[model samples]
Target: MTTMDLHSMTGAYALHALPDDERAAFERHLAGCASCAQEVAEFAATAARLALASSAPARPEMRERVLHRIGTVRQVPPSAAPLERVRRGAARGRGAARWALAACVAAATAFGGTAVWQYERAQDARHDAARAERQAEQVAGVLAAPDARTRSVRVAGGAGTLVVSAGRDRAVFMASGMPEPPSGKVYQLWFDDGGTMRSAGLMDPGRSTQTVLMRGAVDGASGVGITVEPAGGSRRPTTAPIALLGMPA
Candidate 1:
């Protein structure tokens, strides 16, 4: 691979994500480049800290993901040719993008921004896997119903879609890039049961995309709607709806 390509592999290298060939190639690259070596060291230390922090109340999937991650990497063969190449690449003054990405990940770990946060989020997801699987099956049922139909929707920041199965009294909401609600507020879903709206659930803050099954019964409901409310969500919509989507009979 080219120098740029190899530089991009640094994160993967630190994470033990590279395969045998690429791992070997990168170690050769690493042996010569002090900056990359230093960056990798930071990555290793940061990951080690997170690993320690995430150690308690451990879940089996965590181990599974790690084992499945790299299948164990082999030691890199000895190399002696990074100094000259590092000097040349530095003189040209390029390839900062890759290092920036690596540094950002390390920094995020330090700030509790994403690296460990996302891993913990992943653990949360795993905890809900059974419920998610059941939801998936329910959504499948809605999609496969004889009367099922999908309709497109428009929201301020991005498009939305609704799949309705009146025969089954169920619906699914799918959207991407939905704008975040104003501070101290959240997006709430509702089942427009005739003229009466029933609380569904709150959309996750900062989540830009998702496909979710609307909670509660859909029977006799006109459709679904979204409204901004207090962060913990409102018993009923206190603000005007940002968007209203009607269901078909």
Candidate 2:
């Protein structure tokens, strides 16, 4: 390859995407090009991080695909061909090497994709953790309020406690051993502003113990309630509340 072509090959060489001949040429070029060498080092570092989250099991289809590709490779038979065919063994060997190179390229491309997926997953996890931390801080602030008070609550199959803080204009509703909602339904929380019930949020249908910080301002709200509602929940309560704990005066 020309020097110009070789200059652009640092990325491909770093990914092992180059054929043996091209890779050899690139290495020769890299020896004289400090910039290319530095870029290759950086790419190698990125490749290293790609496997950090690879502890998770690979999909079954990935294994199957590799097996299928290997099965299709042309391998020279062991000493069964004519003399001329035997002499051409080197050609067949090169073909097999080319196939191996293709497999390496495929693997490198897959690794890059997995790295991107893992990065996005990590970002999402961090965002969720930060949000949870903020919510926990809010819950703690309410509970620590000077006027904070607790009220007992009871539902059909479980009991709970409501900690309200007029000073903070917030409250936390925590319940234990709550039954899963009916099929095609979910449990929803509401804030009682005078007699009007405002939607707070939905509960985890699969979880029995729930800790929820009532959504929206509890400034004028007097109590909180939980009820069964259709999946996705309603703008307002459509069924009777399973439990209600009044705000302390």
Report, for every candidate in turn, its global Cα lDDT versus the true structure: 0.73, 0.77
List the pairs of residues colliding in candidate 1. 32-82
* Candidate 1 error regions (>4 Å): 1-127
Clashing pairs in 2: none
Report the C-alpha displacement of residue 42, candidate 1, in angstroms.
34
Residue 29 of candidate 1: its Cα lDDT?
70
Tens digit per residue, CA lDDT, model 2, 64-92: 99999899988876665676686688789
> Count of backbone clashes for each model?
1, 0
Q: Which consecutive 10 residues in model 1 have the weakest lDDT in total? A: 118-127
lDDT of 1 at 121: 32
Candidate 2 error regions (>4 Å): 1-45, 48-106
Candidate 2 positional error at 161, Å: 1.6
lDDT, residue 148, candidate 1: 88
Superposed Cα deviation of residue 157, candidate 2 (Å): 2.8
